[model samples]
Target: MKQFPTHIVAVDGIVENEKNEILLVKHRDKEIWTIPGGQVEIGENLTDALIREIKEESGIDVTVNKLVCISSNTGTYEGYNGYGIVPTKVMLGFTCSFIGGELSVSDETSDSRWVSKERVLDYITNPNLIERFKAYLKFDGNIQYIEYITKPSYDLKLKIKI
Candidate 1:
């Protein structure tokens, strides 16, 4: 049997404010706080998808600033339910400016808030989130990426020299 080729395109917006705080969505799936984003539709550009997902999920309108990160990873989510079965996603991350929107919850989100870099540490133990946010916070907003080739095992295809 031939292996199937399935690729899902996803976009995540790192919306930052003048105070350097980042907007994060408290997912209804788990207790993790992640950026607002979703799958990029067929024939749709990456930026357009990020814009749409942020609005839909977090009620936040965004103006994409830059491709801060390009992460390529293949991993199993173990018990992750939202995007199921054979899961392989290509996530395009962009830095964005918050234009205007009210804080609201969607089916996918439990809560949404603008958090300071300091607060991210308080939310540790949420899987690999600590490391992920550390990269974004430590840097001077200098776009980067963290690719996980095999999760569940915490394996990565690209290694960062720390």
Candidate 2:
């Protein structure tokens, strides 16, 4: 059997606008939309990485309200590096408040938009991301723990919503 790669730690911020819409970004290489975030660089704080990623991808500043969920993703997410598949990823989701900055795009992102919670699925399709959004909505004061695995793997671990 081949050895699986090491897990990558990432951070995503759920920014809610005054109108109650969530921010989503479209990567230049993919059509599917997703929340703004990126990998937490070595020696960088999680919150700092969240702020930096959001700003870099969506051109928006944010203040983290609280951590909403922690996702262990074993599914293959495409278009990040030259490699086609991403290894296991532990992503921390945070509920954030918009600080400032106009909506804009960077080389890493093609478009950015504010989407209503009810209509978010209209834009995003990745099962893991959809789970993250659902977890974000269901999040209470406590953090929710989730695991997203590719189908047919038959690895039934456990499921619990905060």
Candidate 3:
């Protein structure tokens, strides 16, 4: 039998507190800030994975409200050996409401904070993350879909609200 390529499925949340602030976390290995999230483990659903990731990375409890966007990207990563092309990553972005828990960082996160909506873009500079955030802002009872390639160059393949 021939082997086939596999894609990674991940989940990210745009958690909002009563004060309208957004939860952002900086991973230990990453310099840029991004919303808390991680890959879904086997036997875990998207919402469950999201909740667990949020709690693990930021020590914050949140309720997944709705999915805002679904994005796929063919991006590369730097490994111990050298730069390698990573499998296509399919991420589901959700809007979540903060339930409870004191804000704290974990081993995976170097820092975590609640940033005002106006200043969120200033902290998150990744183009892909910025696009996901924009999709969250534009969410209107509809889910947005985005597909892009980041290897040779950043090229947007498809973007539409469904």
For lDDT, the strongest prediction is 3
How far out, in Å, is residue 137 in model 3?
Answer: 0.7
Q: What is the C-alpha lDDT of each candidate?
A: 0.73, 0.85, 0.91
TM-score of each: 0.78, 0.84, 0.91
In candidate 3, stretches whose alpha carbon ends up further than 4 angstroms from where it belongs are 75-85
Going through the candidates in the order shown, the clash numbers are: 0, 0, 0
lDDT of candidate 3 over 1-162, digit per residue (tens):
998987889999999999999999998886669999999999999999999999999999999999999999866554455646467899999999999998898889989999998899999977788899999888888899999887677778889998
lDDT score for candidate 1 against the true structure: 0.73
Ranking by TM-score: 3, 2, 1
Per-residue lDDT tens digits of candidate 1, residues 1-162? 898887777888778877887888888876677878888888898888888899988898889987656565677454444646656667766779988988788999889888886775665454334445555555565655666755556665663532
Q: lDDT by residue for model 2 over 1-162, one digit each (tens)?
A: 997677889999889988899999999987668999999999999999999999999999999888888888676656444786667778899999987899999999989999887899899878777777887887777777877676555242444756
TM-score of 2: 0.84
Q: Any idea what lDDT model 3 has?
A: 0.91
